[model samples]
Target: MRIPRIYSAGDLAENTSAELDAAASNHVGKVLRMKPGQSLILFNGSGVDYTATITCVTKKHVIASIESATEIPSESPLATHIGQVMSRGDRMDYMIQKSTELGATEITPLTSERCEVKLKGDREEKRVKQWQQIAISAAEQCGRSKVPLIHPITSVDDWVDNKPEDSLGLVLHHRTTQQLTGIDKPQRVCLLIGPEGGLSEAEIESAINKQFIATTFGPRVFRTETAPVAALSVLQWLWGDFNR
Candidate 1:
C-alpha cells in the first residue's frame, strides 16, 4: 500500500520523535485508525520528506518516530505568484487547491471592482486559515514538499503595484490578444486573474500601467476558478519543470 503523507507544522528530523498536531493526530488516530509500526511520510514545508513510523496513538495525540529524511526536488523553477480575485462559494477553494497542485509559489486573494465576495476582520482571518489548509492538503496529495503560501486578502491595485522587481507580470483578460510568445524567460511570474464579471477597464489599465502585460489563453474565456489551472499549466510547460 502507498504510505500516507502528512504535513507537520513543527520541525522534523531523522532519529527524533514528532508529535502530530491536533488535525494530523485526529487523522492518524481517529480517522485512519493507524496502529504503532505503520509508516507514513511527513513534510514540514522544508523541502524534505521524513519517513516515519507511528510510535504511539491516543485519543488526543499521535506520535511518530522519524526514521530518515529525503530531500524532495519537486519545486518548479518558475516561481508563480497568482493574484486571483475572490469568487463566491467554493470557487475560491477550488482555485487555491488546483493552483497549489500546479506549482504556484504564492497565491493572494484579490478584491476587484467586480468581485462579489466580501470578507472583513475575523471572518477574513478565518477564511485565510481555511484556504491555507486547502493548499496544505493539495500539496500533500500532489507530492509537493513545499506548500504554496496563501497570502492575506488585498485589493487588485495593491497586488498589482507590489509585484517583485524584474518579475514578468501578466494580467489575464479576454479583451486582449496578447499571448505568451517571444518573451524572454523570467525567473518569476506574477499573474493577475480577474473576477467572474471581469475586471473593470480602469483596473485593467492600471495593471498595464504597472507593467503587467495583458494576455489571454484564447478566444474562450475561462471561469475565475479554472483560469489559474489553465494558465499555470501552460506556464509550467513553457518555463517551469514540465519542459525539463
Candidate 2:
C-alpha cells in the first residue's frame, strides 16, 4: 500500500521520537486509523521528508519514529509569485490550493479596485490561516518539500510597487496583446491576476506604469479562480518541471 504522507512541525532525526501535534495526532488516530508498526511519510517543510513508522498510538497522542531521511527536490529553479485579487468563499480557497500544488513560490492576496470581498482584523487573519492550511495540505499531497509562502494581504498598487527589482512581472487582462510564450525567461516572475469583476482599466494601467507587462490567456474569458490554475499549468509545462 502507498504510505500516506503528512505534514508535521516536529523535529525529525534518526532515532528520535516525538509526539505528534494535536491536529496531526487526531488525524493519524481518527482519520487515517493508523496504528503502531505501520509506515508513513512526514515532512516539515525543511527540504526533506522523513520515512517514519508508527511507534505508539493512544487517544492522547500519536508517535512516529524516523527510519530514514530522503531529500525531496521538486522545486522549480524559476521562482513565481502570484498576486491574486481575493475572491469570495471557496473560490479563493480553490485558487490558493491548486496554485500551491503547481509550484508557485509565493502568493499575495490583493485588495483591488474591483474586489468584492472586504476583510479586516480577525476575520482577515482567519481567512489567511485557512488558506495557509490548504496550501500546506497541497504541498504534502503533491510531494513538494518546500511550502509556498502566503504573504499578508495588501493593496494591489502597493504590491506592484514594492515587488523586487530584478523580478519579471506580468498582469493578466483582456486588453494585452502579449502572450506568455513571447516573454524571455527570468529567474523570478510575479503574476498579477484580477478578481471576479476583473481589473478596472485604470488598475491595469497602473500595473503597466509599474513595469508589469499585460498578457492574455486566450479568446475565452475565465473566472477569477479558474484563470490562475490554467495559467500556472501552462507556465509550469513550458518553463518548469511539469513537462518531465
Identify the leading candidate in terms of TM-score: 1
Q: Give the top-scoring candidate (lDDT).
A: 1
| Cα lDDT, all candidates | 0.95, 0.88
Q: TM-scores across all candidates?
A: 0.98, 0.95
Write the residue-wise lDDT of candidate 1 on 12-126 in tens digits: 9999999999888988899889999999999999999999999999999999999999999999999999999999999999999999999999999999899999999999999
Which residue pairs overlap in candidate 2's backbone?
none
- The residue ranges of model 2 lying beyond 4 angstroms of the native Cα positions read none
Where does model 1 exceed 4 Å of error?
none
lDDT of 2 by residue, 91-186 (tens): 988998899888999999999988998999999898888888889889988899888888889999999998898988889887666897767778
Whole-model lDDT, model 1 = 0.95
The RMSD of every model to the true structure, in order and in angstroms, is 0.8, 1.4
What's the lDDT for candidate 2? Answer: 0.88
